[model samples]
Target: MLHRVRSKVYADFVPEFDATSVAKIKAAGGIILGKAVTTEFASSDPSPTRNPWNLEHTPGGSSSGSSAAVGGADGSGCAGSQTGGSTCRPAAYNGIVGVKATYGRISRYGWAPLSWSLDHVGILTRTVADGALMLTVLSGADDHDPGSLREPVPDFSAQMAEHDRPPRIGLVRQYYQDYATPEMWAHTEAVANLLAEAGAEVEEIPVRGGPPVNHSVRAADYGPRIRAGMEMGMIIPTSAYLKAQRLRRQFRADFSEMAAKVDVVMTPAMPAPAPRDLNTTGDAAFQVPWTAAGLPTVVVSTGLSELGMPMAVQFGGPWAQEGRVLGAAQWCERIAGLNQAPPNY
Candidate 1:
């Protein structure tokens, strides 16, 4: 397979070994369906992958091709990466479930780096159950990846149907309300009401921090070297990068303290439905903080926009609690009763 991070620099390049996740899948008798497209070096550049729901709209980027493939029904699941919402953003735009495992939860042995500290192996599937199953199969300790989790991988499939009565869902209504379109936000409130009437303990919550992606990935691991002589800007001081890392850890701690108050935290998966322009992917503001904090998050499509584009709700829990997040997401998905699929292609 070509190891081009969507750049011509390594157009003809082939890797000596499959990425850790790919190798794991292959060993488990999974098929290597061809590679999907990504943004240049998994950065902001928009890829050619179009939204399966609407050709004019974007299938959010970095993981654009993976999401488009699954959302269009060409594939059941795909592995994307997220530094700043690359995975869930595309999955939400495409009307599918996307899971970003906790930082170091899944080994990243051979992924082309966008940001070493922020990159995560992302899973996109038509259902939360499928996403959980993929997460189960792909998760484990890896000798090659120092960052790989040592925590035991449980049977996420078995945990799908298990929920402890009604969940205590902390809804981030006010913070996200400002970000999402009024229609979409109203729809979310309706969904929350629906869940509450159905027996969930729902309560509105507020958060303090905003986007931290601008301070992320001060040095793109292995990514910058491949780009070679591009004149981006002056090199950042190592001290600044360390400071960012420290702040990220503190943010994670703060987020965990807040998350401990509820079963899972909820928000609009995207600010709005997929935008029409292909020049840029949809906003990552909602998903960025979670990524930075190294938290596990899952998004489930709740309904369609007026234009028939997909709108989704994002669920997250404390770090290393993917099971909690996934379980809650599965419940929300069923309650929403929206099995969204793009128009036949």
Candidate 2:
């Protein structure tokens, strides 16, 4: 039987009502396995949930508990929310599958809000198939969530139904490679070769514009530093924020054009594997761009890092292309041959 655990954000903040995603899970015959931990208000504040891979290491957050639980034997899967790397980062850190569908792809009706513009409901599970199946159940427009997109919900599972050939994957190595540890870069190259050997047409691709510059706007609701910035955001002049929004639209346009040339874009999910520190979740740099552009992204474990912790690669597609993004991720998941159980599990 399948179960969907809620995060602490839902438990502590809004216990009375099931988030739209949670309601969908129950309707689809999934058990509500109770709430997992979340960072304080889903921000920089740390949670008690440690990485299952290494108890001393950090489990990425604010979706910490969701990812950690899904990485364990006790839970089947859980609903995570990502404003930045909350979804994909934790999945990568814990060595599991995580999906951040396009912005508004999954209704946020009852989910707690961070940056309304950037927050997205996400899925963390053991496999791409499970992620897609859960996504199919959780996706669709909700009358209550004004931010919800009205696009038709396709059978996400069927979209991932096997393909005759591997996908043409575009490698965007500039920012990702620049920020990643050498070991991560090398591991990524090795995985690319593994995929190519399995028949994925891999090619280098150039990128314009770097990571999004509005972390302040997104992280405003968080801790002191970010909250200070959030306070500034309140008085930063509407014109400036509007200008940033316009620039963001152009960024989205550029990414869409780029996506036209490939079945999926691949990059390291995080600059490095789960950091040894539990003081903070790993950096969100690898995920901010896609989240900023509202593109669909999937994180799959590539293998364990040098420390025997998991390493992962994230694949993203144009907006609302969850099916394509997930399909490619599913293929890579199979060929990468990295799905071993974490030690101690």
Candidate 3:
């Protein structure tokens, strides 16, 4: 999806998807799957694809087709986007695994920016192992994106295998209980119980006022940054954007402190499932704080709601801890026994 978008927007953007990308895939013993549709510019615009589980509902977007393609009968798994909940929401809506890595973990060089500060490349798959496989292929620093970090990308799949004992997991008390729907809250509790039964020490903890600051900073920066980028040909405002950066630093500090006590944090990827209408994508409130703090988050489907829509729980870790985060999410996914296929293909 991102490859197609980049190729369309920038003429100079040569997509690796052509013979070269395909050859690379084959060389690596992979296959060329069909292309998935993306929201224009990978923004708020929803795609026409319906939820695989129920044709009457949306599959979620910008990575709409990607999520649907993964959750749908093709079941190849998805590589979605997140500038808010684009990836997480759709994965939950379609009952698949979605991963929103730490900001800058995956190079954003080819992706069209919605909110430069908030945008992230994420994956949606039916299993945590598949998600990790895609991440291993896609992650790494790219020269084209200056913001892309130079850190070595670890073998995420191997990390998932290394852990024997369950780690201490922190349950975010505020957002999960406050914003989620009754069904969502119930699903979350069931997930907590499953994690505990799997030997994880699940403890409820208060996430301080970081979410509000995260929302505010993101709100204040997105509009102005995009406007300035349009009018003056810049990606972000150097001055006002500083506030978001500074706030992010503080957010990282708070999250790091929390991580010191718990190996991983569990929260819902979105407050609820996909909205009824495709005209508007659902809120990304649950995901903002993680993006703001530059932490790695993996969305794993918990179960289907009474309405048959999907619900997911987010497993997160401190910056540069992608391996640990993916491992824990895989653990939770196994314990929950959620591996259902969506209804539509």
Candidate 4:
């Protein structure tokens, strides 16, 4: 029952016990929802699951099925992972709320490894408040995972308050503007303005140097859109891997110098709406840098594209600062006020 379908390679395999995430959810009185499909080995291959927003479009992957489940299923909440935008991207494509907290904040025991250094457990919920609640239940130390944080988990739901301070937002527009479609770029700008109007202290904080290139470099620089998860692990030389990690540290260091300045860094969730092609999942480019820096990031759906597809904006906060990030996102989500099911397209 725990098989990760791979053309009979793992068809007969079953786990001795539930994954830590599943066990925790059950402990919190969450009824098991059974398994949802991810891509084969949670990689490049697209799954049979269709986007609930538009049957012809992709829901995004390798968490595409999980995204579709949450965005489309009635009274559903889903969980997925992001080694590189797999969780949040799919959630945006399917028009739902996606939150990936700071790396190592959530335990990864029993999760099939894509990149242990980069993988993060993410949740897809319909509201930011729900995301905060789940983070509280799912966070804390795990002896099974050395990377799990040992710090006492805070009351995440309490952090959801709209209390005193207006958030200070940094507008990041480099890679995002370069890659985003025209409509998406304009939408992002408009949303930034809307947030500003709502009293957020928004400002253009354009970054110039030292972007996180290590994660993609380790993923073979993403030259070709293929699922090289396992291949990346076995084939790359130790020296190259070590060098990438070093550069990753530099990226994190450079960002930390500025992360303390902004309550949240804003960007479009994805370059464009879910593409019509099913051969590939939507791009992970926009989501990658934050994931690479291991910053807490969340995607809140803004509305639909002209083609009636969903669009969203991503809000990333300083490392280990999920509280501020999620709170700001909840404020923005309320101001946008455009949540809806897939329209009759």
Q: State which candidate, 1 or 2, has the greater TM-score.
A: 2
lDDT, candidates in the order shown: 0.82, 0.83, 0.73, 0.80
RMSD of each: 3.4, 3.2, 4.7, 3.8
Task: Please write out the lDDT profile of model 3 over residues 1-345, one tens digit for every residue.
Answer: 322452234446555543322333356566657768776556555557788787778777767888888787575655567876778777878788888888787877645666777778788777888888878877777777677868998888998667525878999877568888887888888888888987899998877664734333233323333334455534556765677678677777887778667889998777777777867656777877777677788888888778888888888888888888888888887788765776534
Q: In candidate 4, how many Å is residue 321 off? A: 1.1
User: Can you write out model 2's per-residue Cα lDDT over 246-300, one digit (the tens) per residue?
Assistant: 8888888888778778999999999999999988888989988888889999999
Sorting all predicted structures by lDDT, with the top scorer first, yields 2, 1, 4, 3
lDDT tens digits, residue span 174-285, model 1: 6689888998898788878888888899987766675564442333532443244233423666687678777777788877777778888988898889999998887898
By TM-score, highest first, what's the ranking? 2, 1, 4, 3
Sliding window of 10 residues with minimal summed lDDT for model 2 = 1-10
Best by TM-score: 2
Query: Estimated TM-score per prediction?
Result: 0.92, 0.92, 0.85, 0.91
- Positional deviation of residue 77's Cα in model 1 after best superposition, in angstroms: 0.5
Which portions of model 3 miss their true places by more than 4 Å?
Answer: 1-3, 6-27, 212-239
Give residue 73's error in model 3 in angstroms: 2.9
Cα-based lDDT at residue 88, candidate 2: 94
Q: Which is superior by lDDT, 2 or 3?
A: 2
lDDT, candidate 4, 82-175, per-residue tens = 8788888998899999999988888989887766788888888888888888888889889998778777888877876742246888988776
